[model samples]
Target: MKLIDTKNQLNDKEKHIGKVVGVDNATLTNIQLKAGEEIAEHDSKNEAIIIVRKGKVRFTVEGKPVEVTPEHILHMTPLEKHSLHAIDDTDLVLVQVKP
Candidate 1:
């Protein structure tokens, strides 16, 4: 058995990215962004699920804006283009599963 305290992994960096876990078929990533920081448009080859732990973020998926908060979760299909801007200091966990 193992335990991971996600909050303890946060740092006061501009765009802090940390790996929580990686295995044969899945990977877990931690992403922390300061307000106004942005992640450039990109596409992932694997299926993805993004969980917002705190704060707010605006995700532009295929040219549409989607506001995400702690109460929301986002999922992306493989190779779906997307980009995000931090509306507030944000913490997100991304889980990707191999096909």
Candidate 2:
């Protein structure tokens, strides 16, 4: 078995993005953003599931605003445009599955 560490160690002024795993038809990504940082609008070709592990963010999905917190999870279909702003220092895991 292989082991992967998915951890966020960013300081208050830092942000990070990285791939944690990729196997067959699926991929796992780790995204961490400091408060006020944003990811500009973009779309994925694969289906996506976003798990919020800590802090809060406001996601603009197709021009609509959705607030997400650590207690919430988000999903998107292929090619659905979305962007996000960190409402607080945040840690997120993105899982993408191919068709």
TM-score, every prediction: 0.91, 0.92
Query: Clashing residue pairs, candidate 1?
Result: none
lDDT of 1: 0.90
The residue-by-residue lDDT of candidate 2 on 1-99, one tens digit each, is 998896776863488999999999999999999999999999999999999999999999999999988788899999999999999999999999988
Q: Residue 4 CA error for candidate 1 (Å)?
A: 1.4
lDDT tens digits, residue span 43-80, model 1: 99999999999899999988889999989989989988
Of candidate 2, the 10-residue stretch with the lowest lDDT total is 6-15
Q: Which lDDT value does model 1 have at 83?
A: 97
- Give the CA lDDT, 0 to 100, for residue 58 in model 1: 98
Clash count (model 1, backbone only) = 0
